[model samples]
Target: MALLVIAACQLMVVLDITIVNIALPHIQSALGFSTTGLAWVVNAYTLTFGGLLLLGGRAGDILGRRRVLVFGVLLFVFASLLGGLAQSSGQLLAARALQGVGGAIASPTALALISTTFGEGPARNRAFGVFAGVSAGGGAIGLLAGGMLVEWLNWRWVLFVNVPIGILIVLATPRWIRESPRHPGHFDLTGALTSTVGMVLLVYGFIRAAQEGWRDPYTLASFAAAVVVLSLFVLVERRSRQPITPLHMFADRNRAGTYGMMLSLSAAIFGMFFFLTLFVQDVLGFSPLAAGFAFLPVSALIAVGAGLASRLLPRFGPKPFLVAGAVLAAGGLGWLTLTDVHSTYAGSILGPMLVFSLGMGMEFVSLTLMALSNVPTRETGAASGLLNATQQVGGSLGLSILVTMFGTAGRSEARQQIPRFLAQATPAERLRFRRTGQLPAPWSDQVLTAGVSAAFVMAAVFTLVAALIAVLVIQVRPSDLARLQGGPDPGPV
Candidate 1:
């Protein structure tokens, strides 16, 4: 029952991350949102979710995990309803931001519940495997669900669909989950506020840099504010009697490595989904539903790889699989960077996506296990909260950076082609180029391909960095894991 409740809550939170991508176009049209405003639909949720995750995790420790989980579900449900009925862009963005708060509150509690419920051993390992699979699979599932909902029904149904699921989970929680024992630490209000505000400012700066350039006054101010706030947050954490993120948590070398690896890998993985979705819809002329279906292969491979990793991890140790997964994922991204106008789904996209998913699947499972492997029962909530927070931060930061890169590339390509079009073109042709930021109809393909290729290259670089981090850091062996679990120490890797 605990597993079911936690898994369901996790599914809802993770699904929201990608589910709205397919609905963006529909939402923009219906609500009459400007291009810049439409991005807020995604950023609003991520900003709040990433910022407050540590606070939410700490809340679970101070109060009760079950109580916090229930509150999160209720808040999420109310926010979803508001979003579904939104009459304006402002209302919808506000609702999405509120939904992020609820998600932040609920997610860590779910992981903490699993840690407390399942004793550390094969049983706990298996539970975490399932949990990891659900976490990785949620984005793909959301894409598919969003496409189907937007195509068959109105885009509003994408938000409304969560209402029933949220209600069902809330109803089951009282019966299914038990309350966690409360700790005697005071909430580090100062730490939470500074960290949350710092992250928000940092992400906002990167995102705005895409539109307004790095030199823009607001963008520079945002970055400067982030640095000051985050610096203060670290100072506060060092002095606080009850630090929200205990400094001792980073003492474990393997755990620290896993956290860093997760941040880099998550950035690449989430950026792929963001740009790929845009490519399929905007460049390839795929409908929302069709684009969703295109991701089915990758999704299926991830599930398979995750299930396989759970069993294989106990035998082979995490290092080999982690290294192999990272290398393969990097390779796949490299292949994807070759995408061009003539590329076909089977010949060009499918192979790389499947290979990438396989690597991501293995990496996610191993990294999750490594992160939680040596966590004491008392610190389980804090550990899991930090891991989740890293992924959220990575995703938010990565997407913003990649988007900025894409925008710059697109503008540069457009600028290069303008002179070519002007040299031999009539007055009407030059006017069209000036107005639409591209040559007349036929040259759209060249411009889009260049932009997408540039984005994919950036994603590839991100994945390569992740692979290097895994190789350099994360050195635990199967025997070491056994020792960590109370068995004999195996020889070092």
Candidate 2:
């Protein structure tokens, strides 16, 4: 029952990430968002969630885990309601940020609860496997659900859907989940302030740079603020008693490598979803529901791979799976680059999508094991939060960076076709086209497809680097799994 509660909370959090993605086109049309700003719907949540995670973890300890969990879920439900009711972009973004605050508290606490609730060995392993599988499939599940909701009900249903789930979780949690006794510790306010503000500035800098040129004064200022603030965050962490994030957590080569792998994996995969949604709807002209179903295979393959990895991990260790998954993901992403305006779902998208899903699923299972395993129990919540932080920051940073690439490449492509398009337009049509500022049939479609393909090529590069890190840096061996089975502490890397 405890494990089920934790998994359900986690599934809800993870589901929000990609479920809104399929509805992005609809959201943009309804909300009047520019392409550059549309990403904020995703990034706003991630930024606050990632930035405050360290503090949220510590809060669970200082307060009680179950107490924090219930509060977080309630907050999430409220935020979801606000999002569903939102009429303006500002309202939606604010609601999303609030949702992140809830998720930040809930997600790490839920993971930590699993560690506290379940005994180590097969019991804990089984618990984590269930948690990991749910999380691994959540993104794909979100895509499908988002599609159906947008097609049948409307885009708002995506946010509205969470309210009921959250309400049920809140009601059931006290019945099933046990609360840990509170610990005595200071809140590390200075550290929290520095880290959260720094990350917000950093993410804003990336978003701004994508819209304005890198030389824009606002961009430079945002970047400068980020650097100065984050440096202060490190300084605060080093000097503070009971720091929100203990810097020593990264001293282990394997643990540090796992963090890096999580970041790279997130960067590659987040960008893939962003651009691919555009490809299917804007390029292939699939309806929202059909586009949702298009990604079903990827979700299934990921679930399969995650289940397989859970079974294999105790035998082969995390290293082989991590390396193999990365290689497979890179190959899949590379194949995605072959897509063009004429390509069909079956011809170009399906096979590569399967390959990507299989690889990511394997990586997800292995990565979770590597990141959370062998940590000191006292630091588990903090460690878990940091891992989740890496995923959020990496996604926001990578997507913002890739948005620049997409926008620039797309505009350049469209410019070449403008002269021909103008030649075919009548005087009145030319005036209308200019007034509306819309791209014509083939050129518009070609530009979007080109940008997405380019982004995928870069995503492949990121996954490949993740593979290199797994090969050369991580040192955890298959024998480590045995140490885990015996119920003694899994030795740190």
Candidate 3:
């Protein structure tokens, strides 16, 4: 029952990440949001969720895990209700951010509860398998659900739908779960503040650069603030009696590699969803429902790979899975980059998506096992919180960076093609294009295509780097395996 509750909470948090994406267009249209403002719907949630995760994890330690879990679910439910009822863009964005705060609190606490409830052998392994399965499957499920809600019902249903799920989980949690005792430690307030603010500023800078150029005053200020704040955060962490992010978490080479791999892999996966959704709806002219259905193959393959990895991980170790998954993902992204205006789904999209899913599925499972494998039982919450935080930060950083790159490349390519387009056009056609303040039709195609391609290339490069790190830095051998399994081998990495 405890595992079930944890899995349910995880599914809710993960599902929220992608579900709103499919509804972005609908929300934009309804709310009359500017192009840049629409991004905040997703960014707001990600920023708060990622920023507060460290604090949330510690909260679970300071307060009872069960208490924090219930409180988070209730908070999430209320935030969802606010989002559902929002009449303005700002209202909705605030609600989403609040929802993220709730998620940050619930996610680590739930994982901590799982570690406390399950024994460290088959029971724990099986529980983790289920947890990992839900985490892997939730993104795809969100896409599907988001599409159905936006197409059949209303976009608000996407937000409203979480209310019942949150209620059910909150009720069941109290009945089934045992509360973890609170620990006595000072919260790392300074570290938490610095880290959260720094990340928000950094992400904001990239997002602003995407819209307003790198030299924009706001963008420059955000970047400067991020650097300063992050520096302070590190300094604070070094001095804190109980740092929110312990420095020793990165002491183990394999664990550090696992964290890095997750960061890159998450960036790649989130970027894929972001750009692919645009390609399907804007370029291919698919309805939200069709686009959602299009992701079915990728989703199914990911589930299969995750299940397979969980079974194999206990035997072959995490290195093989990580390396293989990264290679496969890079290949998949490379294939996706080949897509053009005339490319068919089967030839261009489906095959590559399947390959990408294969890598994503295996990479997530293997990295998850590696991250949590050696964490001390007492620090499981902190470790899982750090893992989740890296993923969130990576996604935000990757998307912002890619968006800026895409915007700049697309704009430059569009400008260069304008002269050629005007030369081939009649004076009246040229006048009409100038009147609209939009790029010439031919140039527009080139720009959008180039932008998407650039994003994919960046994603591929990030995954390739992760692959290299997995192979070079992470050394999980048979002897290490013996230690992990608690045999008569020397303990500790």
Candidate 4:
């Protein structure tokens, strides 16, 4: 029952990442969003969630995990209501950013709760496996749910659906979950503000540079602000007694390597979902529901890989699974680059998606185990928060990089194809193209495919780097294996 509550919270938080993705087209049409601006619908949530995760974790430590969890869920529900009722693009983006704040609070606390609830060994391993599976598969599940809501009702339902689930979790949490002992500490507001603001500026810089080129003044300014703010964050953390982010955690090579692997893998997966969702819907002409179902196999393969890895992890340790998963993920993304305008879903998308999902599933469990296996109980919230932070931050940054590539490639392809399209298109089609600067089918297909293919190529590079990190940096000593098996504490890393 405790695990169920934690998993539910995680699903709601993680699924929000991609659920809105499925509804993006409808939201764009309704809100009159620019092509590039639509990403903020996703980024607004991810950036706040990633940036404030450290603060959220610290809050749990000072308050109590259960108390913070309930507070976070309530905030998330309120934000969902606002998002559902939003009347403009700005309103919706603001609501999404609020939802991220709630998620940042709830997500790390939920993971920390797992440590408090379950004892170490097979029991804890099983709990982590379940949490990891939900985290791994939630994105596809969101797509399916978003499809049903958008097709049967409307896009607003995507945000509205969170209300009921959150209410139930908030009610159930106090009843089933016990609170962690509160430690007296300050909020670290300076550290939180500096880090969160820095990340926002960094992400904005990438997004702006993608749309307006690196020389854009706003992009340069954003990057400069990000550098200065982030440097201040490091300096502040070094001096603070109760820092939100414990810098010493990274001193462990194995843990640091796991964080790096997570960063790279997250970047690849986030880019894959964003681009492929667009490809299936716009290029393939699939209905919203069909596009959602297109990713069903991904959820399944991820489940299979997660289950397999969890069972095998105690035996072979995490390194082999990490290496294998990273390689498979890279291979899958590489295969996706074969997608073309004429390609069919089964021939071009499904096989690679299966391979990629399995690899991702395998990596998630191994990463989770590696991240939390030997951490002290007092710092569980900070440790878990760092892991979640890396995933979200990596996603935001990676998506921006991929979007830049996609836009550049897409524009170049569009320029070449437009003249031919103008000559061949019907008068009505030509008028629409001129009005919207968007080509109609067949012609637009090539442009979309070119951009999608380019994005996948870069995504493949990310996963490959993850694979190399696993091979070169992650080492599980026999003593580490003993700790994983519930042996006595190996003292601080």
Candidate 5:
């Protein structure tokens, strides 16, 4: 029962990362967001959630996990209500940022609770497996749910749907989940604030560059501010009595390498989801429900691949899986770069997605094991929070880079396509084009496909970099391998 409650919280937090992605088009249409601005609909939630995760984890250790979890769930529900009622893009973005705050509080603490609640053995292993499965599969589940809500009800329901689930989790948590013992600690507000602001500025720089070119004054300023703020964050962490992220944790080569690999892979994963959702709907002309259902196979294959990797990991160790997984993921993205306006879901999307999904599943289990291996009991919470933060931050940063690629490619394609579109348009269509300055049908589809393809090429580069890191940087020692394979200290979930 306790596991169910914890898993439910994990599902809600992780799923929120992608569920809103499926509804982005509708959200854009209703809110009057520009193509580039729409990215914030996803980034707003992720940036805040990723930035505050360490603080939230420390809060769980200082206060009880159950207490913080309940508070977080309530805040999340309130944010969802706000998001559903939002009248403008700014209002919606604010609500999404609030949702990320609630999630950042709830997610790490929920994972930490598994460490406290279950004794370290088969029971804990089973519990962690359930949690891992939920985390791995949550994105696809969000897509399906978002599809249903958007098609049947409206885009607002994607945000509103969380209210009921969050309410249930909040109500059930106190009765079923036990409180973790509190530890004495001080919140690193300086470190948290600097890091969050720095990352937001960094992302905004890339977003600005995508819209207004690299030489734009605003883009240059954002990058400058990010560098200064992030340097301050490093200084603050080094000087703090109790840092949110322990600086020395990265000293271990294996752990540092694992974080690097995770960052690269997560960036690729997030970009793939964001762009593909747009590709299927806008270019292929799929309905929202159909687009949602399109990703079901990815969920199934990921779950299967994860199960298989867990079974085989004890025998072969993590390196083989990491290398194989990265290669497969890179290969899959490479294949997806072939997509075009005429491409069908069966021929272009499904096969590559299945391969990519399986690789992601395999990599996830190995990455989790690698992240937690050889860590001390006292600092386990910090380690886990750092890993989760890397994932979220990587997604935000990677998406920004891809969007830049997409924008540059998209503008070039649009220029070439305009003459052709004008040549082929009917009298009424030409008037509409001149009035609104929007391309119709085949021209729009071509431009979109060009941009998406360029983005995937970069996403493939990210996975390939992960593969290189796995091969060159991550060295698996005998002790670490044993620890990964159910040694005395398995580390936290």
Candidate 6:
């Protein structure tokens, strides 16, 4: 029951990130959003969730996890209601930010619960397997759920569905979930506030650059604020007795490398989802439900990979799987770059996506185990929090850069192709193609394909970089993992 409660909460939190993605067009239409402005529907949640994750984890350590969990669930429910009721873009964005606050509090605490509750070794590994599997596959689940709701009911149902689930989790949690022993410490307000604000500025800077260009005054200001605030956060952490992040955690070379690798992996994953979702619906003219179902295979395979990797991790450690996973992921993205104007889902996407999804699942297990390995019990929340923070920030930044690339290529290709197309195309063909997004045969197809392929190439580059980092830096052996299985901190490998 306890595991169910925590896992359900984690699923809810993770799924929200992608669920709204499928509903984006509906939300945009309803809210009357400009193309660039619509991104905030996703960004607002991730920015705050990533930024405040450290603080949320620290709170779990200071306050009991159960108490924090209840509060977080309640907050998430309230925010969902607000989001469902939102009538304007600003209102929805605000609600999304509030949802992030709730998620930041709940997610790491839920992960930390696994370490504290299950005795390490196979049992703990099994528990982590469940947690990571759900976490990893939740996005796909969201796609299906969002598609159903948006297609059969209304777009607001995507947000509204959370209310019932959140309420039930809140009521059920105290029955089976044991609270962690609260640590006595002052909240590192300076460290927490600075770090949160710094990340927000940095992510916002990337977002601003995507729409307004790097030279925009607002984009420049955002970057400046990110730098100054992040510097101050480091200085404050160095001095604070009860730091939210124990800087010394980075002392482990393997852990540090895993974090960086996770960052790169997330960048590719997030960008793929954002762009592909658009390609399926906007370009291919699939309904929302069809779009959701298209991704079902990838999601199901990822769950399988995560489960298998979790079982194998206890015996083989993370290195082999991480290497293999990175290779497969890079290969998949590389294949994705072959997507053309005439490419079909089965011909170009499904085969490569299967390879990528499996790799992604293994990568999730490897990264989660690597991040949490050898940490003291008290710091589990801290470790989990850092792992998640990188995920959000990496996704946000990667999307910004990739979207900019996609927009630039798309505009350039359209300009060149459309003029030439008009010269040859029948007037009826031009009018029909423009009105319905129908391509004028070969030329039109090639142009859009060029744009989408550029984005995939960049995503492939990020994954390839991750594979290289894993090979060069992460060195934990199977034996090293065995030592840290059950008891005291074995210190850094």
Candidate rank order under TM-score = 5, 2, 4, 3, 1, 6
CA displacement after TM-score superposition, residue 127 of candidate 4 (Å): 5.9
TM-score of each: 0.88, 0.92, 0.89, 0.91, 0.95, 0.87
lDDT of 6 at 486: 50
Best by TM-score: 5
Candidate 4 displacement at residue 483 in angstroms: 3.9
Across 1-493, the per-residue lDDT of candidate 5 in tens digits comes to 9999999999999888878988998998899986778889989999999999999988998999999999998899999999999999999999999999999999988988999999998999899989987987788789999999899999999999899999999989989888889998899989999999999999999989988999999999999999999999999999999987788989988889999999999889999999999999998888889999998988888877777787777667788889999999999999999998889999999999999989988998889888887788777767877998999999999999999999889899999999988888889999999998889878888888999999999999999999999999999953466666445643332
Per-residue alpha-carbon lDDT of candidate 2 for residues 1-493, written as tens digits (9 for 90 to 100) = 8888899999999999988889898899899987768888988888778877877888888899999999988999999999999999999999999999999888878877887799888999899879877887787789889999999999999999999999989988999988898989899989877987887888788778767778999999999999999999999999988887788989988889999999898988888888888888978889888999998898899888887887887668789999999999999999999889998999999999999989998998787767777787766666777888888988887787777777666777777877878998889868977997776688678877877777788889899999999999998788787553445543331
Error of 3 at 197 (Å): 1.2
Residue ranges of candidate 6 with Cα displaced over 4 Å: 112-133, 174-181, 307-317, 417-450, 484-493
Candidate 5's TM-score reads 0.95
lDDT for model 4: 0.88
Q: Which stretches of candidate 3 lie over 4 Å from their true place?
A: 1-4, 32-37, 115-127, 308-316, 416-446, 485-493
Task: Give per-candidate clash totals.
Answer: 0, 1, 0, 0, 0, 0
- Badly placed stretches (over 4 Å) of model 1 are 1-3, 28-40, 87-89, 114-133, 175-181, 419-445, 485-493
Give the Å shift of residue 396 in candidate 1. 0.5
User: Candidate 3 lDDT, tens digit per residue, 291-380?
Assistant: 888988988988777777767765677789899999999999988888777776777899999999988889877776678767787776
Give the per-residue Cα lDDT of candidate 2 at 149. 94
The TM-score obtained by model 1 is 0.88
Which pairs of residues clash in candidate 4, taking residues 3 or more apart in a chain or in different chains?
none
Q: Judging by lDDT, tell me the better candidate of 2 and 3.
A: 2
* TM-score of candidate 2 on Cα atoms, chains taken together: 0.92
The per-model lDDT (C-alpha) reads 0.81, 0.85, 0.84, 0.88, 0.90, 0.83
lDDT by residue for model 6 over 1-493, one digit each (tens)? 8889999999999989989999987897799874456667887898788877888877887899889988998999999999999999999999999999999899888888887788878988888879977986788889999999999999999999999999999989988888899987788888878987887788777666756777999999999999999999999999999887788888998889888998899889887887777667766767999999998988877877887887877677789989889889989989988887667788887898899999998998779878997788867767877888888978876776676666567667877887787788888988987896545657755665676688888898889889998999998777777655553443322
Residue 268 CA displacement from its true place in model 2, Å: 0.4
- Using lDDT as the yardstick, the better of models 4 and 6 is 4
Winning candidate number (lDDT) = 5
Worst 10 residues of 5 by lDDT: 484-493
